[model samples]
Target chain A: MSAQRRAQVLLAILAVALIVLPFVSGSYVLSVATLILFFAFTGQAWNVMMGFAGQLSLGHSLYVGLGAYAAAGLFFHYGIGPWAGVWLAIALCVVAGAVIGFLAFRFGISGVYFALLTIAFAEFTRIGFDHITWLGGAAGLFIKVEQRDTWDLLNLRGTPKMFYFVMLALAAGAFAFCTWLLRSRAGYYWQAIREDEDAAQALGINTFRWKMLAVVISAAMTGVAGVFYAFYYNNLFPEQTYHISRSIEIILGPIIGGLGTLFGPILGAAVLTILADSITEIMAAAGIEVPGVKQVFYGLCLLVVIMFLPNGIWPAIARRLGLKDK
Target chain B: MSAVNGSPILEVRELDLYYGDAQALDGVTLAASEGEIVAIVGSNGAGKSSLIRTIAGIETQRRGMVRFRGQDIGGLPSHRVCELGIGQVPEGRQVFPSLTVRENLEMGAMLRRARARLAQTLEEIFELFPRLKERERQPAGTLSGGEQQMLAIGRCLMGQPELVMFDEPSLGLAPTIVQEVFHTIRRLHERGLTIILVEQNVAVSLKLAQSAYVLENGRIAMNGTGAELLADDRVRQAYLGL
Candidate 1:
């Protein structure tokens, strides 16, 4: 099939999945699905820079926490709806991401140093938030609870089905945005810079500006996911929301699925999340309890995936299915 | 006021360049006129790349004046310097490896052209390098060394540059490929493009350029018309080895 046809088919399948997911799931399953969708959304955002643009960010949770905190703090203080908070969250993330992107690229900090800088920024943000009592500090802040029904769309305190659907929408949006960016001129610029920045510059690509664009867009999308996470979980703690583990969880999908490949993040998320749940179930069934087994599993999964399938599972599957690159 | 021809398309005066306390280029003066092919030949560590890079604005000169079209561009950024109509086919044929032959060419016009003219420019580049047209969608990295070199040259031409500098255009290639590249360079010259070529391969560059300069130990060891240098006993002994 042509690239357009293939993209259309993949998108159609994803649309069908999003529409059908919440109805088939139980409350607990729906909750897990909601989390999965949120991670997938954020993962796609991170993938835009790290995977496609080749500006690997290890501090992606900075944007996530910023988005979540921005929206959550606004809503908590002003009773603003999730719909309104989303924009502010995204805008804030964009500005922050642009700043970080500019500093790194302007100074020519690339490769592992760029990754370290991102991590450092997120850590700094976490520390700042931990002491900021306005957002409930380390204990975290929760929305006000009254006798409202679980389907409070305005308050964003909805049923598992509601959260699942909202998360599905955000995830779909991210996937679509990534698809468009990858296929568009902007995508070409990003990919070119990612492959070889100096060559990109020689080609007259303003590497600084384009990289900033990637950082900002990716950041804005991740921020929106933070808003989604805040509403879905109804709480935000510095450690939990801004944790490095969250950053790792967000990137694993893109890394395992296929860095720079559309649908890679979604597939990676589905694979990693489902396999993780199944592993826990198998462990429980065998009555073999292991300390921090889940963390070990996540690490091992990343390690094994990187060691064997570095380019990603999607490319392997795509090749197996006789699908050539566009 | 150069006595021989049109105003200098590029001029570097009293250029001094250093790489971490090691003076690479010292008091070098050079000028390239419109429609002229000027070659700079030097052996390894003889400051040829440094001179070209300093002129290209990729490396800063501590003391010098670089003017393009009579405008001082010494302080300009590399991309801006390129936007001022200076295109560089850098050392190592550094094409965007993951991009297609077409996309790599598209990047060359990224400075001042639009999406509308991109198709026209792409076709022009394909016309300039037919091998690229054959593999427009193939990853540049996957191309043979000769094809990659063609793609690199085609990419630089897409900018429609007033002045183009090719650094070691024949580096690390088969003799046939090298000949093909020089032939392309000759063809490009026939089309009235200004070029400044930096090379360690002295004989070939001397044959192609109208005027040439030889750099040795951070200074100009020789400078004259290509025929004059070719006849010089020093150039013949050192570079041509005849």
Candidate 2:
């Protein structure tokens, strides 16, 4: 293996670190770990479209919000467990994904226009959900607190360690899935469409169908992350769930880690989670808390990543470790 | 006319195509038979590209028919058209830049063929373009213009297409590489595969073509056997620069 490929192997080994992390850390540390795993999942989900398929979606929060709402509503009222709720959320997200994909790919919207369409869909859903009360208006809804250590696994309620392990498993699964897809024939078409849509189409790529698959996959994955998000936070609100800020949070990991690289989202999540925790702790200790600090931090990180290492940090770190795919 | 024994591989009749408000091809009619190398030569903006694009189903035709293997294909999508054993190496070497040489070729065989058949096709492509095999892992964008053109042709050939359309395959290549591309075309021609070569390199095309058509402003300006066109004083003055 070349230096770069050796680095990817190292990354796969880093999964061991994640499994061991929760045991060594206190509640605060585990909290941060959970956040990292959550965002890493979101990042991988976002990478499905923005990285592999080259479709920029600045409104991924729509899927998250829809998933959270669908799952939470079912669990709260219909007595549905998260396992069933998750599938329902995915189906709903797929329908939404197809609609959005149709509008963007079929109508030939790309780049900034495509980004705008995603944002519009997200914002519209947020407002509409805020008004729809059968689930719960924007006031938000909380889960019924079960007996501590009663540990309802079916309901996705359990020990913090349980949640930690589940999230880790999910993050790993997503990474594997995206990596395999990239190496597959479908991945070839996605990359081709990403690089040049017209060229891909002329090569008989069937750009529309392939792009729709990207959207559906990304949306479905994001929807799964939404279920996890709802369960972890024990709450759901349309405004918070579907907000543009949430969309930014979802993409931050892949953007920082490495776009289109399997390990990039995990790496990006680790960096951002650590940085966000430190920055927040420092500001609180200094008693000079600024409004929207996380947003500002994300913006700064994006700028720095773009200017410093535009391809993301994975290739550089992978280079040092002697892992080159080619 | 004797090329296919009876049936033409592709036939377009009074096809009209428009781009937005501009008429790109106006009532154009053309045909190509199996086992023939048909050349369409025209100056820039002469609708040569549009003619093939219409036949390939990339551009929608407003009037008339595009019959490929006796089926009216004017309404079909490009991918469907491709799956019917007709593949187009579109204008410019649109090699997927991010894809490795091998991956680019693999994607070319993505239609209905199994991996085993595709593997066989890859062997043939490697035999045709050894440089591609040597640089299998390299990104196609980094290749030289000549190599990129060869990769494009090799990629389309990976589809095992019976009827292939090459648009400006000789563009922006060194003279030596241009001859090499023509030789490959000749080899395919000899294998009984039908080919439509849209080229501005009139001499090389005329040398290889059995029949030739001149597209001017989306209309057929002249059509005849290669020998007949070569002998015409008007063709010699305009295209051959006699």
Candidate 3:
């Protein structure tokens, strides 16, 4: 069989396994799977900007925070459903992305400087959100829990299994969307700009416009992930949602799996989530109290990956499986 | 220089470019008419690259006019200049290293006019440089220097440019490869493509070009027909090493 066909068959098998997982597994396992899909979705969104466009952003939590706050704020005050609130979330994030892109690109602040600028914006938003009484400020905001026993897909009040399925569908949708984008003209332009901006510009690509498009799309997707976070957890804390550490969590999947490839974020999220959960479970059973052990583990994994497989695990695995040409 | 009529396709008048306070190009003036291969030959740091880059809109000229087909295009971005039918094979053959050869050519045909004829252009480019066709699936960075140069030229041509600028096309290559590059340039010129070639290889560039300009210290030192400049004592002593 051809490498592409082999890959498709492998994906089909994996899809079947995931679909069957909730039926065979218990509640805890279902929850873990949901977490994995959540990270995968967010990581894919981040990858579009960083991996595809070569724009580093260390303040992605800004979008998540904005998205969560927009949805939760609207739902709390105006009794709006998250479905309606997500539009506002997307708009807010796109505007934020545009402003940041304009400032960074116009002033020629790139590389680490651009990254720091993103962090600064996130930090500023966090501080502002902490003081905004309309959104509950530093105290945190909570959504009213519904007492309905039946599944309410419209209101998003349902059992953990329902949530798991919703997350799975979202992850799958994101994967398909990214795949389509990677095959499109915009995708080629993004990759070319990523490789060398000057060459891309000389070849008639408007670098500023394309880079801004990447930022806007990526932010919008991350905002959707934030809406999921708000509705699933039913609460939003400015400190927690906008934390730099939370941003790091969103990107870990793509970094660990592979930066530019299609399946990297999905595989990375699965590997990181499962391993971290298992490690936590093992430590808990052994009567060990480790604070931030997962963070330390992530750092170790990143260090090892950088030292060994610089392109991340997915490329190497794909090569070994004969799925990618050298 | 022999008097040739009709408006120049590309005209740069009193262009002054600066990198901070250091002036890279000082009031440099040159023009190229249609169906002419104009050569700009100078030693290292003579602002030949700067002149072409300014004309292509890569560098913003603070005090000058760059007119392409009678449209003033000074200070327009590089992409806009390209959209106006000016393509450049930049210095060092800056191909998108991670992209495959086919994808690199596709990027060259990104503008609307070129994209409309993408398939035909691809076939033509492949015919012009068969090595690109053989390595169509290979990443561009893996190609040899001569192959990369050829790919760069082929890519620029894919844009269907009215005028193509080559910046040091023979910068670092074997003598035979350099000859091959000049031969390709000659073939392109014979097909009636206007070209502006920047080179340090004075003799070869003069032989290939109809008219030539000599730039020294960010200024136009001399301008004449190719034979006139080649016979000039100052040109022979300074650039030709005669």
What lDDT score goes with residue B38 in model 3?
92
lDDT of each: 0.84, 0.86, 0.91
Question: Candidate 1: misplaced stretches above 4 Å?
Answer: A1-7, A145-149, A322-326, B1-3, B18-22, B113-116, B240-242
- lDDT-best of 2 and 3: 3
Ranking by DockQ: 3, 1, 2
Task: Give the worst 10-residue stretch by lDDT in candidate 3 chain A.
Answer: A147-156
TM-score attained by model 1: 0.94
**What TM-score goes with each of the models?**
0.94, 0.93, 0.96
lDDT of 3 by residue, B148-222 (tens): 999999989999999999999998999999999999999999998999999999999998888899999899999
Best by TM-score: 3
Better model by lDDT: candidate 1 vs candidate 2: 2
Candidate 2: where is the Cα deviation over 4 Å? A1-13, A146-150, B1-6, B231-242
lDDT of 1 by residue, A127-162 (tens): 889999999999899876543346877667756777
Task: Please say which candidate is ahead in TM-score: 2 or 3.
Answer: 3
Q: What is the lDDT of residue A299 in candidate 2?
A: 89
How much is the lDDT of residue B28 in candidate 1?
Answer: 91
Encode model 3's per-residue lDDT on A275-322: one tens digit a residue: 999999999999898899999999988998889988989999999999
> What lDDT score is found at residue A85 in candidate 2?
95
Q: What is the TM-score of chain A alone in each candidate?
A: 0.93, 0.96, 0.97
